[model samples]
Target: MPPKSNDIEAGQAIKRLPSNAELVPHAGKITMDEPAYFGKGIIKDLKTTVGTHWRQEMTNFNQKTVAVSMLMFITVIAPTLAFGASYSTATESHIGAIETILATAWIGCAYSFIGGMPLCIIGSTGPVLAFTTVLYDMSKNMDIPFYTFYAWVSVWMLIYAFLCSFFDLTRFVRLATRFTDDIFAFLIVSIFVIKAIGDPFGGVDGILFPFDPNHKTHQNQDADYDFLQVALLGVILGFGTTWLIFYLRSFKNSSFFCSDTMRSSIHDFSVTFSVLIWTIVSKVIFKDVEVASLNVPDQFEPTYQCCDDACTMFFPKECPDQAERAGVRSWFADMADTNGKGWVPIAAAGPAVLAFFLLYLDNGITWHLIMHKSNNVHHGEAYNYDLLLSGCFNFVNGLLGLPWLVATTVPCIVHLNSLAEKDKDGNILHVQETRLTMLFSHMCVGFSILALDLLKLLPLPVLNGVFLFMGVSALPGIQFWNRFLLFFQQPSKYPETPYTKYMDKGRIHLFTIIELFFFAMVFVVQNIKAVAVVFPMMTFFCIPARTHLLPRIFEGWELVLLDGDIFEIQEWIDRKTDSVAEYEASLRGDLSEYEDDATQ
Candidate 1:
């Protein structure tokens, strides 16, 4: 009798295995052919990396790049200013807005031309900020010049970075499973969300409605100057910006749009359009109301204004009356000004070691997430090369007394998503991989120093909305977040992912619970200033927990189902099928032997 149609189809499907070349290396596995020691790995990386360096920028230049550039300009600048302000408080204005802008511009420009992954946006992060604050406190306690000690630490860090790159130590980044990436990504998203709507219920310093509740109205005060009206208008602008962007983004699929191209254009330029519209609304339409604007420097100068001869290494002296204090510090940091402590340079290595690990984990994990198979980024990764570049840039930044920069998680995710070409269902078809957006956006940041007045017109609430949008937009693609939402969902109506289809519901929730625990630990540690310098080390610990500890709790197949990428899941399924076939064949042989003995 002939086989049934379904049987034939199943047989054909079983015969069709994916080619070896088609398999994507699992995130938790190291599959590179280059030798780990010496410079061979770097050489191999550069062969693919250097060749495509120019093509990434020159090819695929389009209108989307321009829109993305403007969008990213706002995205990158807002955080730069925000972090810069934090640094001013943390480091006593040594690394302020101008320093951050300069570092971002110069480093961004250099990396665009030479970086292995141009899409990864480099900026200062919270962990780095926390570490800097700790280092400053240490410097004060030791009675040493902060910038001088900072410069020596960076010098040692540079050496360590080069050595790591040379030895291909960055290959360990492959051990960062989705478990780690999701937690890190979520942490960044949480930061954005919190910063956007800080104590919106009552706090006067809230970003959404920063009206002082303590203000008492005087008889001479203008009746039009109502704090309630100002607060309400600010809320409108903030939420209005977020709503407009999301509405326009959805307009591409809306039936009201006449042309698909027009709808798509509006969607692509949604962020830029929203920002411009809200800025005009705040500055022009509601000119009478005083909303908080972006705090930018009035001139292109150092934030710590002091006359050159007035300030000493240990104690800052009062500035001379009527003298320009902007150029007090020189471009180069004085490493020798260590308050007569000859052992300072040698002792700097201790902090340098911590900074190295911090940068390594920060840069490595972010690159791994960005290069994940789902993102559809075809451009090759340059983990070793990019690390080297970061070390080099940070070395320069440190010498110039600027805050250290690394691959900022939120901004990089935002940049990647912005350039991605997605379908109606939000699957990435292609990312418009280009250097132009990073190059252009950062250049605008550099130029903004001259146009600080223009930037001041942009209300802080509008940026808060942008921050809210960024955090919300990034949430859709995170698998952990999707699984997290499943906790609230009915099992019968659960979305049918591989894990859902194969694994038990209880098992799925257990895996999520474990991941949540790790995330919570990292979050708690990061918030506690006394132990926050260990943030990167704690983040790196997830690798061992995923690789060694997770296996004991879940079966191999279950782990693959829950945490593995698309390719890993497919491979695991194939292996399981083969094992089942072999087991069934052995049972048939045993049964045949028993039947022969019975016949005898």
Candidate 2:
């Protein structure tokens, strides 16, 4: 019999029907005959679980396949070409460039592949490259052994990285706002522009001097001609490659292959192919182009001895004994100098600590924003864990006396979002599932790096094309007009999320404009570092100037509109104070009475 509606609601519900009892029983008695059927069902589910998920993920991964491939190429291959060229150009030795490339590639494979944050292409970054250049210069000036110092620094960096992971230091990423990310990104773009533009000109003083009419052509002919040729070729290729990747990836869709996986991969590949091809072509066309090669003194022969047909350190090689060899101006001098018995060094612990923290904040914020765009995604809680892994990797690289690595902004975001799926409400679906492909890619990179000869065949121009593309791709983020209006006047339209009445997209928009403007200044004026000082000062003045003066100029009621909207502001304040009022008050009671009277 059916229960009355009142009885059901009042908690006097009737017993289950006979049909319902058949469908679901309170208890069951296990029978030996039923074991086979239950076992089959369990086995079937287990077998199908991985298979079902994998198909969807692969389909998603391939959607934006071309773009993803291009990004990978740009991230990995383009830098490989640039590093080789830069080292050769700077040192007049191809071997150093080659060795660094080999080492970086070997390490980068682990970073690019095993790293938890997908789309972060690992290789020689701008700062790390700059540091390497510094190391090289210091080595030349001080007459110190290069490889030994490198090894020493590498060992210590590993120790530092391990400590970072053990302590779980990635928790600080939560405070990082769009402001911090933009600052770092602005800096990164500035650095890239500086290096790209400055490298060709050879610094501030040398730009017009060599090209002056009165200069003797015989003395400077080879050097000037070579510099111009390399510069022109590299710029065209790097920029072109970067552009192609961005162009291909922009054609996003809800269907398969347009998703995160392929889009990012294609973008990487475009960069890689651009760079790699240029390198190969450079070698072929300008045999006298005097480009660099990686062949160097074998690590095993001079530093180690062959024992039973395998390399083994003979003596005083890995860790040299006595003071004379220890203090050489290599990257590892910091470690030896720490004990109070080594050579003169630059800013020690403070700069490195600050640099690491800045890098963490910069990467974490950008990653969070990009990750949020994905349909299927994990919450930011896992960011700490992932960042810990990245930091650990960086620390390990540092110990190798290698350059400290970082998680890049664009690639990481593009990779994850392209791979994500969305539910009916447009919420992101399963994201953690992309781990399989990431693992496979890492394995590929690791094995590929061992073939140093094949890697050397890559060209520089293609890489340049890719570099230019990446820089150009970031331009859209600038939002110049939108930023200008927000900066000068009260925002007519403001971004809003459900929890907050108003959100500031202006920070990012302004930062991007500032970054592009800085890049342009560096390109044109050729003295970018001068702007760094200017930026901090401007930020200081603008923030204070607006906060204090703007409030006074506008009335309290006007201020509400200026900040957001009056109703929205009041609603937020009321909700926040709902639990905190000392005295009970019915502020909305009067309004409710008016509404009731109006209805009557």
Candidate 3:
């Protein structure tokens, strides 16, 4: 491919080469540019085709595999912290930590890879945790071991998720829209706000129904005063520590100031390290301050020790001498050790059937929208096969004691589109050429959960703060409505429009009215707990409008090119049909009338 030595010296290498005139050979041959040669490339692609296909298959398989590790970490860590803190106000259980971490990691693995919109990192959620705590309380009273109840709940959740997946339940999610997502996001954010923010300001007093208000502690002091003081101190510490950490992290990377990486690293370290220092300092200061610290046991062990630190407490090994072994016997019955005394197996037919239908509708809706937004994975809006696989994944998650898992999020599509090169016209120049950053981000999350210790050190309040920040950030995406309103208002910018040109001069009227109403309703519903109880659950209604109605309606409008206002409906009729045909028929009737008049 290199230029001939003569051409190199001549400095005219770019000129087209001329063919040599040969007397003895059939020399009517064409020459091609050296740069145009693609023979080797074609062969190379062919050689790697099978390998490429196999790797893609493997990556998908690993989604579920990696999820297990993530699930284990949460299952062990979250519950241990929650339970140990709750049970003995002063004591912490290391056993609960290990169990929670493992269970959560297992569930996360299934959720991350297999479910509809497989982007939501599912593990131990707050509601589920609350549910578990209730079960634990009930089990203790009934002489049933807590883990047995947890196992039962897990079984139920798995069954629920599986059934949901079976019926392609995610389809219901398609009904939601951006507005709906926003509302749901708002609701979730409100719950966090109420717990973390509102609880400090007399909000907890409203819910104190069955409490022993005047109960004296074992120390002959009012428990309420101690509880209140400790709660207040905790609230202050949690919020202050969370804020400091966030600010530190925010300042770590300075793009504008050109700060050095060393400085950034120090900032990052200080945030977490300072929080750790404060936690220790707070404990030392409060040694006699009556506030709780971490309740971990003296030693950590890996054995499946059920009673003390385990995910759920188990049966007492021994009973008192004369007290008829009711507790022990009941524990056995709770574990279903005897002839079906402990376990009441429900027919999978009743609840399982209900769960399956719910999951199918839910999964179908979420997946379809995810695919559309992601752009890279267009299974099409009407795809049945993709729905089938999604259902199958959820069904499997249920069997593994996971909460009903569904499609992961579709943010990867946005990441893929970001990397895709664009032409002058902004169309994608090529496909599958860039790394899917968000999907890879999901992988990173899975890996972190697997690593265990990395995430464990981060304070829960900081995480909650981050969640709050993200929820706030999502608010701006809704501002596009303002832009749409601006466009609608400027009809002169768009010359041809029946509604805009004639009906209204300013879209400000409609846009402001609609947006204000939506905002008021959303804010009121989210803030007032009592109103939420009274209203129809709005989240489900929000989903489909986001996914299905808007897209389909837009498609319909584009297909028909409908151009008419309320006043111009009759004008849209065909002129030929109305004028020529109808005119002829009218003429015949007029002639008959005229002939009768002439005869008269």
Candidate 4:
């Protein structure tokens, strides 16, 4: 979904003197204090937006939808594909690119039609991959079937998601500041970077245990990969893909792109185009190397197996690597086989509760980032409602034995920027906001399930490169990263962002120091096996630190300048600038301080 087009222009537009015709922002058509859902003004928000976006799409269905759909088709599929491959490989589960595409396309389509925040792009993420992977390992050791245990976990996740909405825990999400958002954002992006650098298979883990293709022997779970022979190709393809992505993103501003339509098209299809070009290049240049390819099959098939002869045990060590996924049919598998006398599902609830907390934090903070005032998304926040809807979707995913989905950070950011139309000044004027683009983009993914073989043609290294590009693109926006740059940047030449405008340079340094500490803590916790399952809980720790500890350390104005919404910062800037002008007037002896004011 497109963000509000005026975001980039907001700072400048608000500076001009107020007039009747100058654009004025409306504080959403409906407002409700979310106190345990007591306000209950949900219908009011829904009614106001019923046809606003739909009408825009109807008016230019052929032109805009085609461009966005094409662009989204290219962008959406690769991540889901890559995520599917990674998740399945790590967990030894039946999840594949096709299933991932199915879920993403299906759930995203439903969300677009009715979900409140269209800007939030949904997909499986690094945390959930880690979450599910750990669960699978646990169930296997305990002799519980993975999917059966997964089904129970899914039930608990949905229940908790609904519980979160019902009790108004949704309100806590609003309290997230840049302090917490950057920490999680950094964590998500780094998964890509670390994965690519550490292993040819992807992720921070440096090894992959390949199995015998002939299916003749027991594959060692600890088998180590020697990527050094093909590592050079990985580096070349990865960096090349990354460069193409960065180049294409900035290409919209290039003179060569010329017309708006051309630039828009390039911007929309940049990721897909970059991936395709490099993939072809890798095939031609590295044909001699036995590099990894995507695990996508040519047609729909079961990623897992189910049979009367199947061993009912969770992950039998006697079973070969492929045989673990060889038990179930591609379409459906019942949980009754592994629920372990109805008590396992009950016990699974404890871990399910933990997973739901992470899901809640990740989803909430992502929504916070996308809907940040600076992003200029004008729609009302439906925290409670969206949470409930996600629970329904996840419950369905559990039943189908598919990967659970969450709001992916980079994709959502990319989606918003693509749908925007910038002015000569390069600030967004307005977005061509419509659900059709999202709907159509996802529809293409659903249709592409049968074409998985085509995706396999591209070497897996190229996909790794795409991941690197995604990680790098997300780095600049992080507050801690920007703040860290100050150590090398000369003080007088600091960038004129809100933090610089209203925060003392030294205080900003201290603020980032505190944030950096949080980032390091979460990173350590997520990577450490003992604490990884509770990573989201560790991430949630930032909220209380900001809410309680930070206030005691920094003054109210400093916190506002550093962490407040755009309007709040602008208000502080206005007052401080006025005070500075008055001080300058006193130095010039133009007027007494006792007077109302004098020109600077």
Candidate 5:
């Protein structure tokens, strides 16, 4: 009930009491002034998932396990093969396919079974790999042993991650709106696309990074193929792999040659199926042609230190036992050398701080992308928990002389889409979230060396094809690219999004221009050796630019339509349509009056 005016007046003399609509505080405090887990919010996580019924999540899990596992295997293998090789070159660390595959299995399975967000797949990623290269160069220049300096850096990184989790700093990730995420997504997707087909679709293999001398030697010398032929063949096989995967994945919507069960299996195994076909073509037709092969170890062996990138772990570049070496190996790196220098451990804090931010931002942003409501992530987010786990994982890897792991973006999405049961309009009905897919897929990777020679039979171009397909596949989800398309499109035939309805053309284009600026800057920084170590941090500038700068030009309504969350965008749409209808009606009324007056 409302307080009477006289009653309010009377109360004003003594105290003003809140009315019915207002929430009144009691005399005594009922809860803590600050939440105990404000920074380490695990209970909030439970509310996101455990609050929802568990039985239904389990039901979806049972229905899709076998199919999802197959999909996971394909997605895991492609990136593991591509990224592992790249990481080796960047860091000068021989974390070859076997090491990369094993790390993926260990981290993926652990995260799947224990992680708060089941959708995320943990592995090595491009940004971290690039950043590690900077450290490797620094260690060599400073006369510090690479592994010892790296261990100290990893320890510092772990400390930073722990502090972030404790302080609840992961919540800041919410500030990275569509403006930043779209740029990062498109940047990565662009890498995959350009790598498959050369920038012009006719140039040599060097899309952005040039070819290394140690790169696979050509096997097509007998065929007398020139530069153009090899480049063209790479383009052909790459696109072929990409298209084949897409064709099989799209079978779910086909009118024929498709049943629900068949569609499920096809979607799950499409990537692996496409890769196998292309591998045979490279081996039989090309006859072991100069295409890149995964540099697997000759036998089961752990890595050891060496000056050369290609040196096997057990032997250094000039080992005394180089010729008469036994097959024994050591997995853990020796940190005792640094234990005496002591300054190396302390100095590590400087680089560690930079590495910390790189890991934190990259890992957190990827989490937000996978868990975005649009993705229909039913499980709760464990941002704090996962950050801590990732730190621990990397710290252990440091001890083991293994490469650090982080959340990989493309593989995670592939895993989710493979298991997601969608409706006719293509929105997720529910994800078949389970550990089995990740666990089983990783197990396959751990034992991959069992088929060592056969595994090396797969050509690198096929992986490039997977890369191209992933980039093309991701384009549909990015609004920045969609808005950019409107520039070349007819206004009358423009696709309907919240912005197309409420925001003006000039405003939307300006929004896209800002995103492009950030994307371009990050790309430049990533390719430039001097500043590339801070590439992920450079992307953070987009957030403040969106919050403070862009609003100066666009109104609240326009901004919401252009880059707001789902509910805000929908609200703007409804309000704008009503305003448009009112204006049209008033204009009609005036036109009719003018017509009558002229007739009179």
Candidate 6:
């Protein structure tokens, strides 16, 4: 007969590899030693990363890759046009839709080919948008050409990026814990959620519900009813798209589905299918109703018209009046168009410092999240090299007066999740890591300039629904979000993870509360324009807070249970059990010796 399960477990030994601290004995402690400088291991790092890069892409040629490419293309386009419009408003048309789309296409294509992580989709972000707006305002106040000043700032930031990379400063990202990462990820998710739902209190300027009183169709006798009709259709399209996507994605697990392969295919192309379904609904069923669509540029030209007679070359029949085109600029920024002040270039470094920190934290944190263990990404990291490349791209963009782009969190997460092969329990088995999706998607964005009218058929609310799905879908993976939901649940019914099993409910709540406090601080600071420039600094403070402050409140073992990964928690438990076993053996030996002495 076989041994009983419990009896066998009692005789089994726990196995674990030596941790970094155990191997080095001084791994996490501060010490004075010869540091790795001048990109000491960057060459070898690149060699390892690049060796498998092309081979990985070649092996990923399948239907899933094509499906993901379509999904990402749609995902990237909405935000590009939306942010481009916002940038034009903020900078008074110095940069606009065409420039943004072009930047997204060119930089995205280049990075997909050579970036350290091809899965990370690079694009413009909210913080970079805010920083550029502030820089433009400063240039205006100081009586300098905004583009020229922006160029100098970009140059200084480029210098700073190379210097930091050469000195291996990106190694500091290892100090960031899940505490910091979750907060930032939650903040981004919140933005997407809010934008997708639109204003509930009857706002006309919402992304999906752009109800203008002066629109051409609104001048009819039944304007009020027409507004209501449009609003109702917008709601249907937006929420309907979201519902269809969720239902189709969940169909894979349903018993009534056609076949396993058929259901999986439906799940794989859920987003694309949802978009198509709703778009057809909008176009065919409500053909006469007016709804908001994408605002694509009619031609691939600079958004800001020329200020001088050069306008006649491009638009001889309908050139703008001289007075209307006074401060307009061309595609290339004039470096010498400054206020004739020699100190301007040096002064530009001030804003460049803020830009550097913003890019460093934003890029580093997003990369950290991508390379996170939960994502199951096998590609090695190249933080320093990626940072250097971003700086170079920004320098070129500044020269051409285009918006600076970074590793946008939402799109990166969406891209990663789309390519991930998950089990029935929703665990990531493997990510279809490849370059083809981003390359093909971005190439389509570049080609979109020719088919602007075709793109106009995609209603804004359908895209908003996609945004809502992306944001809501990301929430399940976040531990913080899971814990926050526990605030309303009974303690007895809580899910039995290592933390919930070993740690007290009160202690878990306390740790979550502290994280919430920091998250609130970052969120508040990010929203306020006056303090937004220090947003990166605010996030950076989380590293020190997690490292220095939390250790005082909780015991080391408890922290491992609460904040550590699965392997970490297991190792801690194994170490404690080993120590207890050794103590028992020592006590037994002492007992035997004492018995011998007594007998003698």
Poorest stretch of ten by lDDT in candidate 5:
21-30
> What C-alpha lDDT do the candidate models reach, one value each?
0.80, 0.41, 0.36, 0.69, 0.67, 0.80
List, residue by residue over 57-92, the lDDT tens digit for candidate 4. 435565656766765665577678777777767766
Residue 246 lDDT (model 4): 75
Give the per-residue Cα lDDT of candidate 1 at 600. 100
Question: What is candidate 1's lDDT per residue for 528-570, written digit by digit as tens?
Answer: 7788878878888998898889877876667777777777887
Q: Per-residue lDDT for 87-106 in model 6, tens only?
A: 88788777898889999999
Q: Compared with the true structure, what per-residue lDDT tens digits does model 3 show for residues 1-600?
A: 644424432232222222111111222111222221223322332234322342342354332232222222322343334433333221122124433333334444443333233323333333223333444455455555443443444455455544443443333444343345434434444444454333432232111111233422114545444555554455555556546655654554445435566554544354344456546545566544443333333333332223433234322332223323222111121334222334423422343343444444334433433343323442123223334443444444333322333332222222233233344433345433211222343344444435555444443433333333323323323222333445555556743433333234344344334434554565565445434322223335444443444344333221111211221222322322334443343433333443465599
| 5 or 6, greater by lDDT | 6
Cα TM-score per model? 0.87, 0.51, 0.46, 0.80, 0.81, 0.86
Clashing pairs in 1: none
| Superposition error at 31 for model 2 (Å) | 58
Q: Where is model 4 poorest over a 10-residue stretch in terms of lDDT?
A: 21-30
Alpha-carbon RMSD, each predicted model: 6.5, 15.8, 19.9, 9.3, 9.8, 6.5
Error of 5 at 340 (Å): 2.9
Regions more than 4 Å wrong, model 1: 1-35, 199-206, 209-225, 307-310, 313-327, 573-600
When 5 and 6 are scored with TM-score, the better candidate is 6
